[model samples]
Target chain A: MAKNGNDKSRHIIQFIWTLITNAYLIGFIRGKIYQGKIKNICVPGLNCYSCPGAAASCPIGALQAVIGSYEYKFSFYIAGFFIIIGTLMGRFVCGYLCPFGLFQDILNKIPLKIKINTFRFDRALRYLKYIVLIVFVVIMPLLITDIIGQGFPWFCKIICPAGTLEGGLPLVILNDSLKSAVGLLYGWKCFILILLIVFSVIIYRPFCKYVCPLGAIYSLFNPISVFKYQIDKDKCVECKKCASVCKMGCNPTVNPNSLECIRCGKCKSVCPKDAIECVSFNKRKTN
Target chain B: MKNNKSRIITVSMLLIGVLFLSAGILRGENIIIFEKAINICLECIGIG
Candidate 1:
């Protein structure tokens, strides 16, 4: 089935609901007022597990725990969860879900609207996210050790605005007695969050483009993702409209599976050539 | 085409390696970093 603009908008709205509810912001508020147990739904994105209001575990955090566990060689649960989600829908998770991605989308809606038309630089910079995935997510925690011998989730500490927004702020507000303990790390996180918010207004999805390790992981499955886009060469006429409307800043013609393409389907909706279609796994041929 | 294909293959290999390696590293120990550090550090400072 073809996607319309309204369908895209609905997806965005649903994404917002998922974010607010899944972040346990709602539960946090409820739990705070009623003294009820905080309930959290473990969604696939990088929502922080430590958010005081959080009812569910962050998938990335869960994965990290499984990895760092001494008794178990690795966490089958976290790995299986990511693999299942990834293999099933791939980066459709980024396009259809992901609160952080939605937040960036909202920020990118600011009407000043100066487009930074730097295609080559954008493509080159997309690789930086992979570097983040490697260095912060993988290497630091495994390699670096303090004198007491504790591993760090370097990515969560150094990056991740979701934690700041969801975990940091709520906890601060709730626990007034805990207010005086501010330090450089909080300042740094606030600085990064502010930077991301400001950049999101100017450049679309600055985090998704440059820093999101989760997006980087999902992008790997783009080539074989079940929810994929197919372009018809026979229908010819490369007007570049698809590329232009793409919020993810990808050329659907050249690299339909681009890590930058969130599969948001703006291109598919606007294609004058009627060239693009969403491909399902069950269907063998592109219609 | 060959160079492009090779580059993609290399990138894919590297990504898979990194994912496994990351999963390995993050299994059990929950050392706070990034935003978690901010939250914890804030809590430590009596802010959060």
Candidate 2:
């Protein structure tokens, strides 16, 4: 009963954080993107830069811009930002802070008969996000250039369902000028967004599992992050309860700091022995 | 010993992050990020 309460609290926290991050009320009302100094700082989640209500920039978008720009090949600021955040909490950002992750969590709550938690090639498909981080977010931007030596943010342009949903839809719907400009590309992105929405209802965070470049980057630091999970094997009875409750499909009994763990705390809540705990920076109990 | 190593890694990574962030700020990378973010990129909205 206490664990279930914690789960409810997690959702409430997710919703509250989402509201705090995208809190430019004037922008939402006027269909304009916030151009404040706050926008200079990139939020840890996958919120879009062009979102009418977004008061902060998306880190992935900022990373691509720096890598793709003619004047700057790379930005130390952005790199440092990722390192600091990734090393501190890792994919806990995905679990608690991401708007898109919240969207998926909400969708997965709907009662569905055919919930596809995992299927064949599920583990293999997890690598696709890293490939996207490399190819679309990193390599393509540096390699391909326009006449003026400017490069495109390929992921934002061709992919990034978050951009399409959070930024594209609102702006286009509110502004008639943007409506006429919308063409086949917009249609394609909308289709992808729709497909993802449907999939989210059936599957648990399919995008985070298979396509989110930000999730990919953070997942790399799950093992070494200052905030991490610790499982006490002495207390554990080797029951598979923790594994079964994990929506991200991580087995905390075998590996407490699995790369796939979003630090959602489901395993911690469900552990019968009270063995799993989220601890900070090498604070393991002596037992 | 494992705990000690983890502490070292965390501190080292944090110092490195601070170093890089300082360097980027000195290079005016924040200005570039600000400029890019203030304007709505056509591509970001899935158009143009």
User: Which candidate gets the maximum DockQ versus the true structure?
Assistant: 2
Q: Note the Cα lDDT for every prediction shown.
A: 0.63, 0.90
Give lDDT tens digits, candidate 1, residues A1-287: 24466456856675765655464455466323111233212466666656554445566655444343334435544555565566556788877677677777777777875755455687788899999877876667566755644445666676768777766666666666544565677777778889998888888788888888888888876776556777788784899988887777789999877767777878887887888877754234344
lDDT of 2 by residue, B1-48 (tens): 888998999889988988988988888888777888888777888996
Q: Write the per-residue lDDT of candidate 1 for residues B1-48, one digit (tens) a residue.
A: 543553455456445645754654465222322223223433222233
lDDT of 2 by residue, A1-287 (tens): 76688779989999998898899977877988999999778899999989988889899998888878888888798889988999999999999999999999999999989999799999999999999999999999888999877789999999999999899999998888999899999999999999999999999999999999999999988999999988787889999988998889999988998989998888888778999988898675676
The most accurate candidate by TM-score is 2
In CAPRI terms, model 1 is classed as incorrect
Worst 10 residues of 1 chain A by lDDT: A32-41
Q: Name the runs in model 2 displaced over 4 angstroms.
A: A284-287
- Give Cα distance to truth, residue A258, candidate 1, Å: 1.8
